[model samples]
Target: MDKCAILPIADLYIRVSTEEQADKGFSQRYQEEVLRRHCEVNSIQVGSVIYEDFSAKTFNRPQWTKLFKSYKVNKGNRPQVLLFTKWDRFSRNTAEAYATIRSLEALGIQPVATEQPLDITVPENQMTLAFYLTIPEVENARRSLNIKQGLRRAKKEGRCTGLAPVGYINRTTETGVKYIAPIEPCASIMKTAFEQIASKTHNITQAYIHATDNGFNKSKNCFWRAIRNPLYCGKVPIHATPHECEQYVQGTHEPIVSEILFFNVQSIINKKREQLPKRSNIEYLFPLRGFLTCKKCGEVLTGSGSQGRNKKYYYYHCHSNCKSHLRTDKLHHLFVEQLKSFKLSENYYPICLKILKRTLTEEAALKTKTTYHLTKKIDELNNKIKKARDLLLQGDIDGSDYKKIKAGSEVQINILCEKLSALQNKQRQLSKDVNTGLSLFSKLRQLYEEGDIHTKRELTRLIFPEYLVSDGKCFHASPVTGAVKRLYNKEHSFTGLFSYNLSIKKELLTQSDSLIIEQENYETLGLSQQNNVSTSEVNEVMSLINTLAKIITIQLLK
Candidate 1:
């Protein structure tokens, strides 16, 4: 009997990375041909040919896993040999390769590299096999280093390095320089979604519905990712490695949404996240059912339906010991009437508008100064980075030290850039915000009446930050700001509402200046401490000044 005829059958495994697929000699087809020819010449029967297009940095490959499964299922009759075109096709990690080869031998299967076959019977050939395995590992490491260096250079040149996000399409110029350009429909959809969320006219769910209606077929997670992505606002994030720090660099592509809208959407998204737990799963036609509380026991009021002689009646009552009950119709009617009191008087609208304009003008001037200073700081940091790079090139600083310093400078630069972006965005949106405020003020009552359940709840929260319900009447309904408080006070005459006390106005101006100083102090204490100066605090100070100005203007109207 011929020994060749008794050789065990073999399974051929072939793999090529994306980059290798483009190389003529290392293509999957070429690898398969070589492995098949070697098995034929050895008189070994061919069982199966497996192909893979993933990396060999790990042994957890799809086809490789399947091969192991098939061998275990048909152990006694399975092919006893595994063949690959080269040691690299088996694995680039030498330690893993050695361990895997031992495991294979234990399973009665022999792993063979066609081009570099090793005879395990010879002790010296084992060392030769280890050397062959190490060559691929070295080559893989070198390729990885070169790729990282190339990516760093591209990022430094303000080029996008990865696949484009939802709204952008990747493109390459005639010279082969890659770039991203905005794609149609999806870009418009994203802009509209951001605007809707920022304006508080719609929540994320509603925005998602609108997106799907307009040809956006991605999952909710993908939609949310697009909403949160800063790339839409013309900034690119450079990822960090274990040795290097991460940074955000301004992108070369055009921004689809304004920075103001993007930041505002982020703020809204955060608020929604915080509120998600408190939101009710059960739907109630009456918006105030869950929000109302009993004044006596301070227990949340729950709603229920009662059967009358001929019809059903809906009512909200304290589920606790206190027997307080109110019909939903009566409560809703009273709430609507109360909301009407928060609306601005038509005659006071123009005076209110003028005061807001003046205040915004002053704010714009201050913000412009701050933005200029931040820009100066950013430029200084950029200069420091350039100097660090130059030092590294001149061999004055080592690579590791240069990277450390550059990373620190880049972090500070990113912080300053964020601040500058916020200031510039606020300045750009000032006029639009003023107009929106005036419009919302003028139509507060109308909006509340026509709004859906969720909108009604939001409007209620805005007007009455804290309130109590007792004997079917709303009480302690404090306004959110001084301006709103003055509007709701029935004691003030229309003329008195418009009239300004010069002395009080002067005092408020001094207070506003002090508040600005206080804000600066808070910032110096760091961002965590700065949160103490809440949105309500800043709004209160600004509102007080505007209210004083309006009160002063009413005197002029007289």
Candidate 2:
């Protein structure tokens, strides 16, 4: 064990944890200087100088590992001492640090902390060594606990901590308070993307392609994650803890998309609506391929051409072992005829048109009312919580009862917030939708009859959300969508104007008067109001109608 006098060469092990690097005296340079001066004062030789910029949470530092390897591999000319500024510099993990010290001592190398010297020979000094090692470990635990609690607090405050998401960038206020601000084209692009996805007209791929065209710079996987992130909709996900399940908090940051739109996209992504993408020209024969199913067996109808003597005849038939088949032409004609019921007669057209516009206006106003009431209720609930807190502070109520009240109020507020978000989102499109729905109902027959495969499939999807069953001559869209219910409700006669039903939900035939409209804001659709209705302009507005018809069809999908 004799390294000879003046030959106890010490390997200078200077360590500074990442978080401590900016501190006044915890720098690696400071540690090196102290160790070198200690060596100079003791006439000790300096061996290899090792510097580590890592955490002392473990003995896994790169430099430490390499030195430990050298100690084990090469016995000759090895350092006699492993000198650092403190025991924590050696390791914050007490057990690993003790093991490492024993290993060094086994190799005839004494581990010395220049700042906190210990005489291993003195039995009582072992307690002092434990004290020095344990303090840093306790410090690390406390620091971690504080960080977690701070992060949880930030989430509850609806603050976006750490790096801002794709559409947002982290910013600091003039006073250095942190916040998230919407970033450029990505923010606008993302907002449009959410609306597109929510509309169900554009699938995820189409939305991605549109975004890319509009300067969306993200990979497909990244785009998927971006759309799924609730942060875009102003919801922050709180991490799960032992006492509570993971929750979503309304964020303070501005939302690129509404909560309703975000959730709608989620549902679409979750199942893609089980709706097939628009077919190509090759699939023109079966425009309703995915939307039509066998009335008998409930299987999707398959389209195929029959080989005949002179020409091939196309037909939709059950692929299963069932005898259900219909000529493509006949089914197409029947569907067109079914849509004719949607078209109002020239005599009653204006009256029905007025009714439709009035209904849309009333629906919009009802939604606005619903949104207002939900918000008001939420405020009232919050005030109740505040009052309960005051009572608890004044010793009027026990903590347990106050907690129950707070929990119940919070749940109700969450539900109301969700409903409010949906109403608000729908309201944004309601004005445009009123026009779109009127145009769509204007000529359901012509649109379906002339539309290409894409348009035809979309039209079918709206008319029949799940699938329509055709029993030879007629197509039956049971559990009818609200739009279709107006066209074919059993109780309502097409002999009259298009007042099929107003139930709005399940019954679809109730004569209940629940809502009134703000007539000033809503204009008549004028389906046949204009004596000289420009055909071209109607077509133009009709084109704008587009997939936004989904607002009317949301009942079936929502």
Candidate 3:
């Protein structure tokens, strides 16, 4: 046998990151060639060539793990040497690299960095090995910091710092500068979807269907990400670090949707999120399966479809010991009837509007006071933080004490900032929310009647936050506390929990007449109402009309 054939077997481990693949020295091809030549020259037999296109930040790489497992499983035929072009190619983490090397030595396998070879027998070469391994780690950290700083600067300059959001495509200018611009059909589709959602004509599911039909074939998660991303509204979110504050910067790109419409969609998304648990799958035709509670057992009612001799039958029944069953059609009909009873009369529309306005006004005043107090508290905390820093500088306070006080102040500041942001958002959307509330309240019955199964379920859940079914009827129905519940209960004469006075009607009418520019405003808003309302003032009036329409429908049902 040849002397080289008697040499111990070795495995060549080659790795290259996507970026490093182009570098001749660090490339996989280059590393493989170097290892092969080194093995041949050193009279070492090559047993296997393992190639990996992955990061060396950790030892959990696919090829590395496979090699380790194969070695352990076939100990009799295991390679005595593991060869890589350089120490950095083996691992970027020094601690992990040293530990793994120790383990390889114990297993009778010597790991060698071909280009930067070190004999383990020499004590000085061990230190040299560590120094060589640390270079790559330091380089990685510096590269990461540079990338982060570059992104931050780009964001500050009003440039799109990451991948373009849906509805927009990234384009490079002739000057080698990149910018985001609206893409054809997709931009239009996104715009229409936003409008539909804002107008309550469609939910997220409907919007998703519309987009998919228009060639937006992405995952449901991607679709939601598009909907929730603020980048479409001309704002870029700067992610916060542990010590930094989160903020939104105006982008140079044209907005796909207005701020008002964007926020309205956000509000709708939030409301839908709250009702997600109650949402039913299309497989189950009965939307109220999990919503209803068994009156006797206090357990949740279950729903199922059964096939009879002639046809299929759907029903809701108690799951526990209590045996209670009702046909799906009968329960749904009763629920619809109960829902219609909440609609208000036409005469009561103006009255309800007046009540809602007063309630909102009082709420706005209370919020203003709360915001002011929070602002003052935040200012005081900031002052304390400044004084603490000064004391630390002067050596009046120890570093630990200053840090504790600074951390506490920062926590308080962050809380106050969050509260302030919430209050500001509420203030901005107060009018829009009131308008939506009045509009939805008026069309409650019509929406329920015309909506699909999903919408019907959502409406039912919103109207009755919690309810119990017993004796083929819904009982203990706990409606959400707001204008809808108040008007619904009052109209049905179900309860006498009145919270407003009718005396405010005259004053409210006077204020409404002055705030609205009756005919011209109506024409501008494309409304046929006779009342004189300003173009800007038509939202509240329109809301009242929507509310009236719903109430009128329900009243006719009665």
Candidate 4:
């Protein structure tokens, strides 16, 4: 007999679901071994093993793709056979399984399962094959539905589900679901990150370093993601459905950050984006920003395209009919000199301290009002209980009436008790704020002075009320306090135009003094002013200056 006539061979296909991989011993390797033995006993040759590490929901699997390709390419070859561990392992959709089997038949390939009845391929075995394939697929679908239904019910009963975000760990008990405690290394890093960002002393990179120094090795993207996530503030995201994420539910979890710090970090990120530079192919004349507004008009002195002598150059022009143009280099040098003269008085700290004290007092009064409401509710509950008892003692209340009154009083008492507990917690948090506010302001100022481009931009938005340019003048408009107005204090204005102009003069004087000092002792003053800066060096300096100017303008406004 020819070898082809004597031997029957088959391709092995195995599959497993994610849930089955965890709970069952129905492994691909084991199924392949079992099928190998079956092939040997049936005097068959093993053609190939094609398996997929995926749920057999549809025929869109890698192994299936390979199988179809091989079947099509070997159109006139010896008969091909496909073998699987079981029916559902082959496919979980009944109509799809039937259609796929019919396609294999058309390609001169046979489908067989080691666990399926051998009579399935017989003409009279239609019912048996359908039972083997269709029944298991339906069972698989039903089981999946049941699992999801159970999970939904658990969530509705207030159970926490899904992976715990970095700062939290999900805990469940007979009482209810809660975010119990923090994971040590993760939680500590999270706390430090929040404090560092809140301090404003550190940029995103510096904050990442602080976290890494404390033994956290999370990715830079993860660090930013953690900062942006509201889950750190104790909110849980519960996805809507298994098939569709249409909505979310916030679970109760222990927070790792205060609401104020979270909002402040967000503010920093927003301002950084606003200040980020956009690349332009052609150089612009208004590159020296944050200073030198149109002298005639209040509009910003901005760069516009210009053509001269068959070459292109950018000019800083007042489009608002101020009608003046200045070279980019001259404007840059002038702006730098003007920036040096601005200074804050030593009384700035005292002014900030007084403001914080008054705010803390206002917060304390609010807490006291909340406490009063809780106490009032408690008194009302007591009165209701006494009246219910009086009615019962006088035999004027029915059983239902007594039960209703008792239930209402209990509910009221529970509500008041919860409110009282919440108020007490708020009081403690407010106390911490009061104690820390003074230190916070000092830290904030230091951060503003030392912060990188991004950090400074964030701080600027926090401090400055508005940014406006008009009539070649740039000045900050700070909110005038209600108390200051009551005392008839004039609105304070900090003008960048005067500050930059004086700063340039100061730089000139400092240079002159340095030159005189150098003349006295050539050896003592080793530094020498270089006549030329390299093109690359000049470009770097210009970029740095622009970034620094933006930071300063933001800070001065604050």
Candidate 5:
């Protein structure tokens, strides 16, 4: 019996990249039609059609892998040919395409391009295939090079090239130029966060909370990145290349903050990272730990409780073999007496209060001027938004363009509103603020003795300025703010802060010509003494302490 002869069959492979479809008019359907017509004209049997929307840079495509798997599984039913519209449609890489073609031939299948067909049986035809494959590969590389160059040029021009950062949205101009613009509430919120961090008013956690309350919902990591991004400061960071190092360029977009503010925030963040977090349960019992050092080893003293027959006694230890230790209560008494020595006499009280109020009045007036300008800016932004809305209604601008404008304007308005509101609050409390500012000068000793551990520690930092060294009997600050020593009178009754020989229970802080902790050393912002107390409130109280301390400096300097 004579067996029936099998007919030649080909599976059509159609691929259309997005760039090719838009630029070169390549379509999967068009390629399929041409391939089918070629098979029809050649009298070859039509098999399956394999479609791929992926790139042809390699043959590791899902459809290509699936087709190869089926050929191995259904060898008897598999087509004898793999057909595509052109060589580039099969693969852009010459090496991979040649390897794939050889593999197909080994599987009793011939890979063919309909538009540029060549017989594999002819040895010279391989050269033609290489030429066809090489041209497209070179074109692909050229396209990639052009794209990279275009993006680099755009970045150098201060145009945002990719997705916008938080608080911004990507938009295009009427002439089709793409850019990023700030959006609503998020932009304002981010600005507030930046200011707070820069001014050291709020720690990162507090700033993140402020952002969250103001409508930001991203993760902490995202917030951190947003704060660090120089885009907020209107600087575009160009990526590093072989020829050039990475650098920042001035951006055309409106900045959320000034460059100085942004860099200040970065510095604060870096310092926070370098400084270790302090978590001690005995803060209330031993508030002087970080402020005290050993006279012998010069190491910061640590505190611990010792059990005795009568009661548990707390002592500051040198944490070394020198065994320098002091009773915590006695040291506390010495610190309180030092603070009391700064108190003004009944005659100087009126002069000090008058000076503090005058300084505060000048500050409040400057703040009022700032508030007025902020108000003016807000009104301008509101009017801009109104004009944009009118343009939208009159068909002068499309909805997307109007939306971008409105969003940007609203962000500016929100930020100004926050600034204005804060200013108004400060102005409202001007009289109270003056009194608050004098608290450190008049009532610091009382406050330290009665206030929480946080208050005591802050007092220690402000008065000592640096480490206070003691050997159980005598102690003195390394240095104090010179303003405290400069407090003088015509009567010569009270000469200086250290001139008073203070003694409490026979432990005296010896008069020294030195000062206390530097303002930069105030790194205990995160230190919390008690449970259920808000960190923000602690920050507020600490801020008040600093303001008072500053007032003292200004008053004495005058």
Candidate 6:
């Protein structure tokens, strides 16, 4: 029709790299349709189509070269435009990219994108183009780095990182991620999975697939990673590599299973990995494996099994050159008997209470006596210095003598000032000690008498700080200032382990004779002796108790 009419396009080109052409978003068919619509609107003629479906790493692209040649020789109305999906689809390298743009401009065609047009242009325009592209890239990189750092920190704190392992469920808490210990509902599934794989009913791959199909779509690599991951074990893996394994970093989260069960699973996996697997002949139960130690050498006394012709039995054997081995059951029984003697309820309370009071009172008395002496000395020095100054300033002495006396008085004043400051600090600390001592002892006693299993465990750990079994006898080192040491034999040189085994002799009761009652005890015992006691006063008293307790019990008690 018209000579200046929109020129028909020669060819429609489309390209997408593997990295780009995912999720049908950058498919060639989709791009072709969009480009064709662009062509139809512009009245561009179609000569030939060129497409690239691989990487843009090099200029040796076949489809691109074909498009260049077609534009060069075609003597008819030259194709006015070379259309692509986007700028990155053209080329990633800047040099090759510019060359292509220049070459296209030299021919009667313009290199254009279905999305952004100005991006495939001069250096200045490309720089602006890079600025736009960099936003998403930088964000992606920052997110990746953050995730990596979070994983490292979580691992050091003993948290389970990444997806929950096959045998475990992710336990979400305010304290961060922990793996749920295998119990009831989930344990059956986990046990079955392990048993099936171990017995070769299904290989690991099949097991993984089956688990995934049955709503455990964490992936095969995830399953394998879980199998190798030591987070399931209570003893956290220091590092993925054996060389770095020695540097153990404690994790903060709760363990999914016990150390023994975790080790057993790991052993099974290790056997499968090795070409020539040597199966462990015996199963040993090391009850005091983590606790007991050799006095001569600080090495732990590990438990081992003895295989006889008829039966197999377990024993605790010292790894050091000392002959220390005993039947496992006997040693466990001995531990129970020793623990029995400790009497955590009555004996522990009276002993801990006595130690607590005596130590606190001693600390307070020390503080008070020191402060009193320092104050007395300060008063004496101040009086002496005042008299000296009066004598000098009253013209009763020569200028030189006055100066000498004033200098000497200043020295005494400085010493007194320092002593006064020390006394004040001691006074403050004594006040704090009184409050802390009362609270700590009271809580310990309550925890001993009415505490749950966990609380009792904490109390036991606090009192029985050390315990050892040597030559079929148990020994414990109770705190020197503790009730156990006070009521027991004072000359007995604090037997570190065997002391816990000693009976709570009746004499220990005498130590709690002069118990110093506290101001806070009135409200703590909940003895609202007077109904007229104001609610505000009661609330204030309760508020001082414990923040955690106050949050829950505030309304109920009020």
Reference-based lDDT, residue 1, model 3 = 79
Instruction: Name every residue pair that clashes in candidate 3.
Output: 442-547, 442-550, 516-533, 517-532, 517-533, 517-534, 518-531, 518-532, 518-533
Q: Report backbone clashes per prediction.
A: 8, 0, 9, 12, 12, 17
lDDT of 5 by residue, 1-558 (tens): 322245688899999876667654478768877888898788888889888988999888988899899988997987888888889889999999889888888899988888887897898987888899999899999999999999889989998888899889999999999999999888999988897666554678767865775588899999999999989999887776765655677787888887767876877888845542344534447788888888888999999888889556889998889998999889888777767666644333433444456566667678889988998899889899899989999999987777667756764575567667767887787665555555546667876765545556766665556788877666754565433332322343232212222243112212222222334311233232433445454444344444555544333321
* Candidate 3 similarity to native, TM-score: 0.54
Instruction: Give all TM-scores, in the order shown.
Output: 0.56, 0.57, 0.54, 0.45, 0.52, 0.29
Model 5: CA > 4 A from native: 1-5, 195-210, 219-221, 265-547, 550-558
The lDDT-based order of candidates, best leading, equals 2, 5, 1, 3, 4, 6
What tens digits encode model 3's per-residue C-alpha lDDT throughout 372-438? 9999999999999999999999999987777678767775576577667777777776565544544
Candidate 3 local distance difference test against the native: 0.70
Better of 4 and 5 by TM-score: 5
List runs of model 2 lying over 4 Å from the truth: 1-6, 196-213, 218-225, 240-249, 265-413, 420-558
TM-score of 5: 0.52
Ranking by TM-score: 2, 1, 3, 5, 4, 6
Candidate 1 residue pairs in backbone clash: 498-551, 498-554, 499-551, 499-552, 499-554, 499-555, 500-551, 500-552
Question: Which runs in model 1 stand beyond 4 Å of their true positions?
Answer: 1-8, 14-24, 27-42, 45-54, 192-215, 258-558
For model 4, the local distance difference test gives 0.58
Better of 1 and 6 by TM-score: 1
Local distance difference test, each candidate: 0.71, 0.72, 0.70, 0.58, 0.71, 0.53
Q: lDDT, candidate 4, residue 251?
A: 34
User: In terms of lDDT, which candidate is stronger, 3 or 4?
Assistant: 3
